[model samples]
Target: MINFVKIILIFSLMASPCNSLELYGKFAQGGLITGKVDKKIDLYVDNKKIKISDKGYFVFGIPRDQTNEIVIVTKKNKKEIKKLIKKIQIRKFKIQRIDGLPKRKVSPTAEDMKKIRSEGKLISKAKNINSNLNYFFDSFIRPAKGITTGVYGSQRILNGKPRRPHYGIDIAAPKGTSVLSSNSGRVILSERNLFFTGGTVIIDHGHGLISIYSHLEKTFVKKNQLVKKGEIIATVGSTGRSTGPHLDFRLYCNNVPVDPDLVISLN
Candidate 1:
């Protein structure tokens, strides 16, 4: 009966349910992963339904502190077709201490709290826009020329007080240095000054993928404007709660913050 068992194994392998599933990109925390499946199937990550493009392309993000294995499920109609388990690579973050930030900026006043809340709503609304543009499939470019001063997933201790982790890359450059668009996208939010991230601009790269430029000296693009890859969208500067002239660039997929440096390195 050994031959009979071998024949059954071959038939099972041939009929595997997830043969059409394909994935790409880093499978670690703060990483962006692109996936593909049969156009007729639905993809879900951790039970959240992911948006699949017309061409079967989809994307997801791993949060910085996601340490557990992610469960990816595919379904056709109401039937569960297959499941894939993705183990996340844990990251060790550095503790970054900023000594000289203004006390008010670090710990805002009651009036400042209102401004922070209002500005935060705008930023959140912009980043959560889901579009079908599909420009995220293109390779990304560096948004500025500068020395890398900070990195993603680093703990921030601002003015002697511990704060949240830094979710963006800080590129040190001279004030007024042009900041380019990392990918072709539509500008969703362009604010001249916010409470924290002054002169911020957010671009939607389609499929829940977005790019954010903060601490800008100037903004060249407006809300709803279409920008091309490497196009000048802003200039570097020390604004808001910044310590020096630098560009704080960030990327996100499905509203989950990701590493901008990792996204560019994917090219």
Candidate 2:
């Protein structure tokens, strides 16, 4: 009778749904996480369907100021699995005061607002381009070799006025200093004379991963161009809303802006 009961329990367990998901990488704020699941179906992060690689791999990131838990749901043929990721560490950032910004930059005129809006549309459009490339899995290199001027998540106070938290890394270099691509990607945005970021370039590194190079002195690539890792894509510049010539590098995955210093090796 005991053997019969054990056999019935084993069969019941085998009939139940199972999940064999493995997630690796940082799970804290401003961290990127890559994971693989048992089967390829549909995956949603925070209720939004994000891009998944061709090999059942998906990537996502926690924003700089996010404090809530992340929920990932995978569904296949009416069967669903919900993963509740709750161990996100909070980050404390410092406030930075800038007193030397040009008055025009700090306080943009009405015409500047129009141009800013137009350029912002272009940037947003580029970020929405999802491709099948998996180049983000490749280790990234520093976009420019320079002294680290600023970091991500730092609160920005321009001319004593509070602004958005800094979402990228700032590396100071002389004008015309070559800027390199950290990973292989297709150039999605190559704009010059933008109101704020000056000559900005954004590359799509496949699967909703994007890299941005802002305030460039010169852009060596054009829109929709393919670039390899460590290739020269731009030059350091102080154009747009900058005090000196510097490269503002940013990394994003699935619409979440993450800290490049944490993901990519700078040293």
Candidate 3:
């Protein structure tokens, strides 16, 4: 008989010849799910191969608006085996409206568009990193101390024009406020200035999981640098399409944006 495991918060699936597989974390929209399996077993989420570390740990993210049940399949000896179906809870998002001054930031000219496109490539490259480090298993801390002004999955209306849903949490703080690393990871990309994010820093926490810090006033870390959790990596600032000083904190699992709040709860 095949076993299918349904998860709510925490559970352990026993599929023998392999011992026990433990899973935990939020299982809702914009949630990040992580688990551990035996080294000999192969696992997948939604048919996409999950990169398991040598110690048998793996991670994946739930889409912000995903309503369909997640499918988890495991195979061994090049043959089909057990499966686990995870159902994610739905969430209601908030609407945010902002009235700003500069028309160019909202609607850029052809010249600015060229720069935006190029900077986008850099950001995308950093977000897609899949390293083998297992730093993601560490406890996470808030990137900075501030009041949350914007939340994940929120609809943003800028100057009465609708834009893409906000994927990061906007924390409002005074300029030069210190921003710390949420967890131990290697810096993958550190750009002083980008078209939208201004000064940005992206850290890879291993196994396709990464965290992004944007709108920085100054960066203390450089590319390929290893940072410890709660270490000061940068200072907050209002740069690149901003009205005031703030930090836009974000996290991505396999390039899919997940809620930073949900991830921090893993601590």
Which candidate has the highest lDDT of all?
A: 3
lDDT string for model 1 (162-250, tens) is 99999999999999999999999999999889889999999999998999999999999999999999999999989999989999999
Query: What is the C-alpha local distance difference test score of candidate 1?
Result: 0.85
> lDDT order of candidates, best first?
3, 1, 2
- Residue 57 shift from truth in candidate 3, angstroms: 0.6
lDDT of candidate 1 at residue 94, scale 0 to 100? 87
Our model 3 lands, by Cα RMSD against the true structure, at 4.3
Per-residue lDDT of candidate 2, residues 137-218 (tens digit): 6667888999998988889999999999888999999999999998999999998888888899999988888999999989
Off by over 4 Å in 2: 1-19, 39-41, 81-84, 265-267
User: Candidate 1: how many backbone clashes?
Assistant: 0
RMSD per model, one decimal: 7.3, 8.9, 4.3
Instruction: For model 1, state the Cα shift of residue 238 in Å.
Output: 0.7
TM-score of each: 0.92, 0.87, 0.93
The TM-score, computed over Cα atoms with residue i paired to residue i, of candidate 1 is: 0.92
Model 3 agreement with the true structure over 39-97: per-residue lDDT tens digits: 77788788988888999888899989999999887776756566778787788999999
Candidate 3 residue spans exceeding 4 A from truth: 1-17
lDDT (0 to 1) per candidate: 0.85, 0.79, 0.86
